[model samples]
Target: MTLSAEYEKLEASINKSISEHNPRLDSFLFNGGTLLALAVTIAATVPWPDNVSWLPRVLAGLGAFLIGAERALNFGERWRYHRRLRDAYQSILDRFTLAVEASGVQRDELLAKITADLDQIRRSQGDIPNGTPLQG
Candidate 1:
Protein backbone atom coordinates (compact mmCIF):
# COMPACT_ATOMS: atom_id res chain seq x y z
CA MET A 1 0.00 0.00 0.00
CA THR A 2 1.03 3.61 -0.53
CA LEU A 3 1.97 5.90 2.32
CA SER A 4 -1.36 7.71 2.09
CA ALA A 5 -3.18 4.40 2.34
CA GLU A 6 -1.05 3.41 5.32
CA TYR A 7 -1.72 6.75 6.99
CA GLU A 8 -5.46 6.32 6.50
CA LYS A 9 -5.27 2.89 8.09
CA LEU A 10 -3.32 4.28 11.04
CA GLU A 11 -5.94 6.97 11.53
CA ALA A 12 -8.63 4.34 11.60
CA SER A 13 -6.62 2.37 14.14
CA ILE A 14 -6.38 5.48 16.34
CA ASN A 15 -10.13 5.94 16.20
CA LYS A 16 -10.65 2.29 17.07
CA SER A 17 -8.34 2.56 20.03
CA ILE A 18 -10.37 5.54 21.30
CA SER A 19 -13.64 3.65 20.90
CA GLU A 20 -12.24 0.68 22.79
CA HIS A 21 -10.92 2.88 25.56
CA ASN A 22 -14.12 4.90 26.13
CA PRO A 23 -15.88 2.29 28.22
CA ARG A 24 -12.90 1.91 30.51
CA LEU A 25 -12.56 5.67 30.85
CA ASP A 26 -16.22 6.09 31.69
CA SER A 27 -16.06 3.40 34.34
CA PHE A 28 -12.97 5.00 35.86
CA LEU A 29 -14.58 8.44 36.12
CA PHE A 30 -17.78 7.00 37.56
CA ASN A 31 -15.90 5.03 40.19
CA GLY A 32 -13.79 7.99 41.11
CA GLY A 33 -16.80 10.23 41.60
CA THR A 34 -18.57 7.59 43.66
CA LEU A 35 -15.58 7.18 45.92
CA LEU A 36 -15.31 10.93 46.39
CA ALA A 37 -18.98 11.17 47.38
CA LEU A 38 -18.71 8.29 49.82
CA ALA A 39 -15.68 9.82 51.49
CA VAL A 40 -17.51 13.12 51.91
CA THR A 41 -20.56 11.43 53.42
CA ILE A 42 -18.47 9.43 55.81
CA ALA A 43 -16.60 12.51 56.85
CA ALA A 44 -19.84 14.34 57.57
CA THR A 45 -21.20 11.50 59.72
CA VAL A 46 -18.15 11.09 61.86
CA PRO A 47 -18.83 11.15 65.58
CA TRP A 48 -16.64 13.82 67.05
CA PRO A 49 -16.64 16.27 69.97
CA ASP A 50 -19.70 18.52 70.40
CA ASN A 51 -17.69 21.59 69.37
CA VAL A 52 -16.72 20.17 65.97
CA SER A 53 -19.39 21.78 63.79
CA TRP A 54 -16.73 22.97 61.36
CA LEU A 55 -15.76 19.40 60.56
CA PRO A 56 -18.31 19.02 57.74
CA ARG A 57 -17.06 22.21 56.08
CA VAL A 58 -13.52 20.97 56.26
CA LEU A 59 -14.52 17.61 54.85
CA ALA A 60 -16.56 19.22 52.10
CA GLY A 61 -13.62 21.37 51.09
CA LEU A 62 -11.41 18.30 51.00
CA GLY A 63 -13.98 16.49 48.87
CA ALA A 64 -14.15 19.40 46.45
CA PHE A 65 -10.37 19.42 46.19
CA LEU A 66 -10.33 15.70 45.50
CA ILE A 67 -12.94 16.07 42.77
CA GLY A 68 -10.96 18.90 41.17
CA ALA A 69 -7.79 16.84 41.23
CA GLU A 70 -9.62 13.88 39.71
CA ARG A 71 -10.95 15.99 36.85
CA ALA A 72 -7.53 17.55 36.22
CA LEU A 73 -5.92 14.12 36.08
CA ASN A 74 -8.63 12.91 33.73
CA PHE A 75 -8.01 15.83 31.38
CA GLY A 76 -4.26 15.26 31.49
CA GLU A 77 -4.66 11.59 30.66
CA ARG A 78 -6.93 12.39 27.69
CA TRP A 79 -4.51 15.05 26.49
CA ARG A 80 -1.64 12.55 26.57
CA TYR A 81 -3.66 9.94 24.72
CA HIS A 82 -4.59 12.43 22.00
CA ARG A 83 -0.96 13.56 21.73
CA ARG A 84 0.06 9.97 21.07
CA LEU A 85 -2.64 9.61 18.45
CA ARG A 86 -1.47 12.80 16.75
CA ASP A 87 2.10 11.52 16.82
CA ALA A 88 0.91 8.38 15.08
CA TYR A 89 -0.77 10.55 12.48
CA GLN A 90 2.49 12.47 11.91
CA SER A 91 4.40 9.21 11.53
CA ILE A 92 1.93 8.05 8.92
CA LEU A 93 2.21 11.36 7.12
CA ASP A 94 6.00 11.03 7.07
CA ARG A 95 5.78 7.53 5.63
CA PHE A 96 3.19 8.70 3.11
CA THR A 97 5.59 11.36 1.83
CA LEU A 98 8.30 8.80 1.16
CA ALA A 99 5.87 6.46 -0.59
CA VAL A 100 4.35 9.14 -2.79
CA GLU A 101 7.79 10.40 -3.78
CA ALA A 102 8.74 6.91 -4.84
CA SER A 103 5.54 6.46 -6.88
CA GLY A 104 5.66 10.04 -8.24
CA VAL A 105 1.97 10.57 -7.48
CA GLN A 106 0.57 14.13 -7.75
CA ARG A 107 0.51 15.19 -4.07
CA ASP A 108 -0.80 18.76 -4.11
CA GLU A 109 -4.41 18.03 -3.19
CA LEU A 110 -3.44 15.56 -0.49
CA LEU A 111 -1.06 17.98 1.15
CA ALA A 112 -3.68 20.73 0.99
CA LYS A 113 -6.27 18.51 2.68
CA ILE A 114 -3.89 17.56 5.48
CA THR A 115 -2.89 21.16 6.07
CA ALA A 116 -6.50 22.33 6.14
CA ASP A 117 -7.50 19.57 8.53
CA LEU A 118 -4.66 20.31 10.97
CA ASP A 119 -5.48 24.01 10.84
CA GLN A 120 -9.10 23.28 11.69
CA ILE A 121 -8.04 21.15 14.65
CA ARG A 122 -5.63 23.77 15.93
CA ARG A 123 -8.27 26.46 15.79
CA SER A 124 -11.05 24.38 17.32
CA GLN A 125 -9.22 23.91 20.60
CA GLY A 126 -9.00 27.65 21.08
CA ASP A 127 -12.74 28.23 20.58
CA ILE A 128 -14.00 28.05 24.11
CA PRO A 129 -17.67 28.36 24.96
CA ASN A 130 -19.02 30.23 27.97
CA GLY A 131 -19.75 27.95 30.91
CA THR A 132 -19.85 27.88 34.67
CA PRO A 133 -16.60 27.32 36.46
CA LEU A 134 -16.32 23.80 37.82
CA GLN A 135 -14.17 24.93 40.69
CA GLY A 136 -14.27 27.82 43.18
Candidate 2:
Protein backbone atom coordinates (compact mmCIF):
# COMPACT_ATOMS: atom_id res chain seq x y z
CA MET A 1 0.00 0.00 0.00
CA THR A 2 1.00 3.63 -0.49
CA LEU A 3 2.51 5.55 2.41
CA SER A 4 -0.49 7.81 2.64
CA ALA A 5 -2.83 4.86 2.67
CA GLU A 6 -0.79 3.15 5.38
CA TYR A 7 -0.79 6.34 7.41
CA GLU A 8 -4.52 6.68 7.06
CA LYS A 9 -5.02 3.11 8.24
CA LEU A 10 -2.83 3.68 11.27
CA GLU A 11 -4.62 6.91 12.03
CA ALA A 12 -7.97 5.23 11.84
CA SER A 13 -6.80 2.48 14.14
CA ILE A 14 -5.54 4.97 16.68
CA ASN A 15 -8.79 6.88 16.56
CA LYS A 16 -10.80 3.72 17.05
CA SER A 17 -8.61 2.75 20.02
CA ILE A 18 -9.09 6.16 21.56
CA SER A 19 -12.82 6.11 21.04
CA GLU A 20 -13.26 2.72 22.65
CA HIS A 21 -11.05 3.44 25.65
CA ASN A 22 -12.61 6.82 26.32
CA PRO A 23 -16.07 5.44 26.97
CA ARG A 24 -14.71 2.59 29.02
CA LEU A 25 -12.71 5.01 31.11
CA ASP A 26 -15.67 7.30 31.53
CA SER A 27 -17.96 4.47 32.53
CA PHE A 28 -15.50 3.12 35.07
CA LEU A 29 -14.87 6.49 36.70
CA PHE A 30 -18.48 7.57 36.65
CA ASN A 31 -19.91 4.36 38.05
CA GLY A 32 -17.19 3.98 40.64
CA GLY A 33 -17.51 7.58 41.74
CA THR A 34 -21.28 7.38 41.89
CA LEU A 35 -21.25 4.20 43.91
CA LEU A 36 -18.70 5.61 46.32
CA ALA A 37 -20.74 8.74 46.76
CA LEU A 38 -23.88 6.76 47.38
CA ALA A 39 -22.04 4.65 49.89
CA VAL A 40 -20.83 7.72 51.74
CA THR A 41 -24.28 9.28 51.68
CA ILE A 42 -25.86 6.16 53.09
CA ALA A 43 -23.21 5.75 55.73
CA ALA A 44 -23.66 9.34 56.86
CA THR A 45 -27.40 9.77 56.63
CA VAL A 46 -28.92 6.39 57.40
CA PRO A 47 -30.23 6.12 60.91
CA TRP A 48 -29.34 3.18 63.11
CA PRO A 49 -32.20 0.87 63.95
CA ASP A 50 -32.68 -0.28 67.52
CA ASN A 51 -33.93 -3.78 66.75
CA VAL A 52 -32.55 -4.55 63.30
CA SER A 53 -28.90 -3.90 64.03
CA TRP A 54 -28.01 -5.72 60.86
CA LEU A 55 -28.97 -2.56 58.93
CA PRO A 56 -25.87 -0.65 60.01
CA ARG A 57 -23.73 -3.63 59.27
CA VAL A 58 -25.23 -3.87 55.83
CA LEU A 59 -24.68 -0.22 55.16
CA ALA A 60 -21.10 -0.46 56.33
CA GLY A 61 -20.59 -3.47 54.14
CA LEU A 62 -22.04 -1.61 51.20
CA GLY A 63 -19.76 1.35 51.85
CA ALA A 64 -16.76 -0.94 52.12
CA PHE A 65 -17.76 -2.72 48.96
CA LEU A 66 -18.00 0.49 47.02
CA ILE A 67 -14.71 1.81 48.32
CA GLY A 68 -13.03 -1.50 47.63
CA ALA A 69 -14.42 -1.60 44.14
CA GLU A 70 -13.10 1.86 43.43
CA ARG A 71 -9.63 1.03 44.66
CA ALA A 72 -9.57 -2.35 43.04
CA LEU A 73 -10.67 -1.04 39.67
CA ASN A 74 -8.38 1.97 39.88
CA PHE A 75 -10.70 3.75 37.49
CA GLY A 76 -9.30 7.24 37.93
CA GLU A 77 -5.76 6.11 37.21
CA ARG A 78 -6.86 4.07 34.21
CA TRP A 79 -8.71 7.07 32.83
CA ARG A 80 -5.62 9.22 33.19
CA TYR A 81 -3.51 6.52 31.59
CA HIS A 82 -5.86 6.25 28.62
CA ARG A 83 -6.03 10.01 28.26
CA ARG A 84 -2.25 10.23 28.16
CA LEU A 85 -2.06 7.47 25.58
CA ARG A 86 -4.68 9.13 23.42
CA ASP A 87 -2.81 12.43 23.55
CA ALA A 88 0.45 10.70 22.73
CA TYR A 89 -1.09 8.96 19.75
CA GLN A 90 -2.50 12.29 18.59
CA SER A 91 0.92 13.90 18.85
CA ILE A 92 2.38 11.08 16.81
CA LEU A 93 -0.30 11.52 14.19
CA ASP A 94 0.32 15.24 13.97
CA ARG A 95 4.06 14.86 13.78
CA PHE A 96 3.88 12.12 11.18
CA THR A 97 1.59 14.14 8.94
CA LEU A 98 3.75 17.22 9.19
CA ALA A 99 6.94 15.31 8.63
CA VAL A 100 5.58 13.50 5.62
CA GLU A 101 4.40 16.75 4.11
CA ALA A 102 7.58 18.75 4.74
CA SER A 103 10.41 16.28 4.24
CA GLY A 104 12.16 15.65 0.95
CA VAL A 105 13.44 12.32 2.26
CA GLN A 106 12.73 9.04 0.48
CA ARG A 107 9.18 7.92 1.14
CA ASP A 108 10.18 4.40 2.19
CA GLU A 109 12.81 5.60 4.64
CA LEU A 110 10.49 8.19 6.16
CA LEU A 111 7.68 5.70 6.51
CA ALA A 112 10.00 3.18 8.17
CA LYS A 113 11.32 5.74 10.64
CA ILE A 114 7.84 6.95 11.47
CA THR A 115 6.63 3.41 11.89
CA ALA A 116 9.52 2.74 14.25
CA ASP A 117 8.68 5.88 16.17
CA LEU A 118 5.08 4.81 16.42
CA ASP A 119 6.13 1.45 17.76
CA GLN A 120 8.39 3.12 20.28
CA ILE A 121 5.61 5.37 21.45
CA ARG A 122 3.30 2.44 21.90
CA ARG A 123 5.92 0.52 23.80
CA SER A 124 6.85 3.43 26.06
CA GLN A 125 3.26 4.22 26.85
CA GLY A 126 2.19 0.69 27.80
CA ASP A 127 1.53 -2.60 26.11
CA ILE A 128 -2.13 -2.69 27.10
CA PRO A 129 -4.05 -4.06 24.17
CA ASN A 130 -5.69 -1.34 22.18
CA GLY A 131 -9.48 -1.31 22.32
CA THR A 132 -9.54 -4.03 24.92
CA PRO A 133 -12.86 -4.01 26.70
CA LEU A 134 -12.69 -2.96 30.34
CA GLN A 135 -14.33 -5.28 32.81
CA GLY A 136 -16.09 -4.00 35.90
Candidate 3:
Protein backbone atom coordinates (compact mmCIF):
# COMPACT_ATOMS: atom_id res chain seq x y z
CA MET A 1 0.00 0.00 0.00
CA THR A 2 0.95 3.63 -0.33
CA LEU A 3 2.65 5.46 2.46
CA SER A 4 -0.41 7.61 3.00
CA ALA A 5 -2.63 4.56 3.37
CA GLU A 6 -0.20 2.98 5.79
CA TYR A 7 -0.08 6.15 7.87
CA GLU A 8 -3.87 6.27 7.97
CA LYS A 9 -4.03 2.70 9.24
CA LEU A 10 -1.48 3.33 11.92
CA GLU A 11 -3.18 6.54 13.01
CA ALA A 12 -6.50 4.77 13.32
CA SER A 13 -4.94 2.02 15.37
CA ILE A 14 -3.32 4.46 17.75
CA ASN A 15 -6.54 6.44 18.12
CA LYS A 16 -8.42 3.25 18.90
CA SER A 17 -5.92 2.38 21.58
CA ILE A 18 -6.28 5.82 23.15
CA SER A 19 -10.06 5.68 23.03
CA GLU A 20 -10.20 2.23 24.57
CA HIS A 21 -8.19 3.29 27.61
CA ASN A 22 -10.24 6.43 28.20
CA PRO A 23 -13.34 4.72 29.52
CA ARG A 24 -11.39 2.48 31.83
CA LEU A 25 -9.62 5.46 33.31
CA ASP A 26 -12.84 7.42 33.70
CA SER A 27 -14.64 4.53 35.35
CA PHE A 28 -11.89 3.95 37.84
CA LEU A 29 -11.62 7.62 38.76
CA PHE A 30 -15.35 8.27 39.01
CA ASN A 31 -16.39 5.11 40.82
CA GLY A 32 -13.39 4.86 43.06
CA GLY A 33 -13.55 8.52 44.03
CA THR A 34 -17.27 8.34 44.71
CA LEU A 35 -17.00 5.29 46.91
CA LEU A 36 -14.05 6.68 48.78
CA ALA A 37 -15.86 9.95 49.42
CA LEU A 38 -18.94 8.20 50.70
CA ALA A 39 -16.94 6.01 53.00
CA VAL A 40 -15.01 8.91 54.47
CA THR A 41 -18.08 11.08 54.82
CA ILE A 42 -20.05 8.42 56.64
CA ALA A 43 -17.13 7.54 58.84
CA ALA A 44 -16.59 11.13 59.90
CA THR A 45 -20.21 12.23 60.22
CA VAL A 46 -23.45 10.61 61.36
CA PRO A 47 -23.18 9.23 64.88
CA TRP A 48 -24.33 5.64 64.77
CA PRO A 49 -26.45 3.95 67.42
CA ASP A 50 -24.78 1.59 69.93
CA ASN A 51 -26.30 -1.35 68.10
CA VAL A 52 -24.19 -0.59 65.01
CA SER A 53 -21.18 1.17 66.35
CA TRP A 54 -19.11 -1.07 64.18
CA LEU A 55 -20.49 0.64 61.01
CA PRO A 56 -18.09 3.59 61.26
CA ARG A 57 -15.17 1.22 61.66
CA VAL A 58 -16.31 -0.73 58.63
CA LEU A 59 -16.55 2.42 56.54
CA ALA A 60 -13.12 3.47 57.73
CA GLY A 61 -11.83 0.08 56.68
CA LEU A 62 -13.46 0.49 53.30
CA GLY A 63 -11.76 3.83 52.86
CA ALA A 64 -8.41 2.26 53.61
CA PHE A 65 -9.14 -0.56 51.17
CA LEU A 66 -9.93 1.92 48.40
CA ILE A 67 -6.65 3.71 48.94
CA GLY A 68 -4.74 0.46 48.86
CA ALA A 69 -6.63 -0.69 45.81
CA GLU A 70 -5.76 2.54 43.98
CA ARG A 71 -2.11 1.99 44.69
CA ALA A 72 -2.19 -1.65 43.67
CA LEU A 73 -4.17 -1.13 40.49
CA ASN A 74 -2.26 1.98 39.37
CA PHE A 75 -5.20 3.25 37.39
CA GLY A 76 -3.95 6.83 37.24
CA GLU A 77 -0.48 5.70 36.29
CA ARG A 78 -1.77 3.53 33.50
CA TRP A 79 -3.96 6.31 32.22
CA ARG A 80 -1.07 8.75 32.14
CA TYR A 81 1.11 6.20 30.45
CA HIS A 82 -1.43 5.65 27.68
CA ARG A 83 -1.86 9.40 27.28
CA ARG A 84 1.85 9.89 26.85
CA LEU A 85 1.92 7.15 24.26
CA ARG A 86 -0.95 8.79 22.46
CA ASP A 87 0.93 12.06 22.33
CA ALA A 88 4.02 10.36 20.97
CA TYR A 89 2.02 8.58 18.32
CA GLN A 90 0.22 11.80 17.45
CA SER A 91 3.50 13.63 16.93
CA ILE A 92 4.74 10.93 14.58
CA LEU A 93 1.47 10.79 12.71
CA ASP A 94 1.47 14.55 12.31
CA ARG A 95 4.93 14.45 10.84
CA PHE A 96 3.98 11.61 8.53
CA THR A 97 0.91 13.43 7.30
CA LEU A 98 2.94 16.54 6.57
CA ALA A 99 5.59 14.52 4.74
CA VAL A 100 2.95 12.85 2.62
CA GLU A 101 1.37 16.14 1.77
CA ALA A 102 4.68 17.66 0.76
CA SER A 103 5.18 14.87 -1.81
CA GLY A 104 8.93 14.66 -2.08
CA VAL A 105 11.70 12.08 -1.87
CA GLN A 106 11.85 12.92 1.85
CA ARG A 107 8.49 11.14 2.29
CA ASP A 108 10.22 7.74 2.28
CA GLU A 109 12.74 8.91 4.84
CA LEU A 110 9.96 10.22 7.08
CA LEU A 111 8.11 6.92 6.75
CA ALA A 112 11.13 5.02 7.97
CA LYS A 113 11.55 7.43 10.85
CA ILE A 114 7.89 7.11 11.75
CA THR A 115 8.14 3.32 11.72
CA ALA A 116 11.11 3.37 14.05
CA ASP A 117 9.48 5.85 16.41
CA LEU A 118 6.25 3.83 16.49
CA ASP A 119 8.19 0.69 17.33
CA GLN A 120 9.89 2.46 20.19
CA ILE A 121 6.58 3.72 21.52
CA ARG A 122 5.05 0.24 21.36
CA ARG A 123 8.02 -1.19 23.19
CA SER A 124 7.60 1.38 25.95
CA GLN A 125 4.18 -0.09 26.66
CA GLY A 126 5.97 -2.88 28.51
CA ASP A 127 6.71 -0.39 31.24
CA ILE A 128 3.02 -0.36 32.15
CA PRO A 129 0.71 -3.24 33.02
CA ASN A 130 -0.38 -5.58 30.25
CA GLY A 131 -3.79 -6.97 29.16
CA THR A 132 -4.61 -4.06 26.86
CA PRO A 133 -7.12 -5.20 24.26
CA LEU A 134 -5.27 -3.33 21.54
CA GLN A 135 -1.64 -2.32 21.05
CA GLY A 136 -0.46 0.10 18.40
Worst 10 residues of 3 by lDDT: 127-136
TM-score, one value per model? 0.38, 0.65, 0.71
lDDT of 2 by residue, 32-131 (tens): 6767768765775677768866777776777777677667766666666677677777777777787667655665566677778778766654444333
Each candidate's lDDT (Cα)? Answer: 0.57, 0.68, 0.71
Candidate number with greatest TM-score: 3
Candidate 1 deviation (Cα RMSD): 9.6
Could you tell me which 10 consecutive residues in candidate 1 have the lowest summed lDDT? 127-136
* Clash pairs (backbone) in predicted model 2: none
| Candidate 2 positional error at 119, Å | 0.4
* Candidate 2 weakest ten by summed lDDT: 127-136
Error of 1 at 65 (Å): 6.9
List model 1 lDDT by residue over 69-109, tens digit each: 65655643554445554564555456446545653344655
The residue pairs found clashing in candidate 3 are none
Rank all candidate structures by their lDDT, best first, as comma-separated numbers. Answer: 3, 2, 1
Query: At residue 113, what lDDT does model 1 achieve?
Result: 62
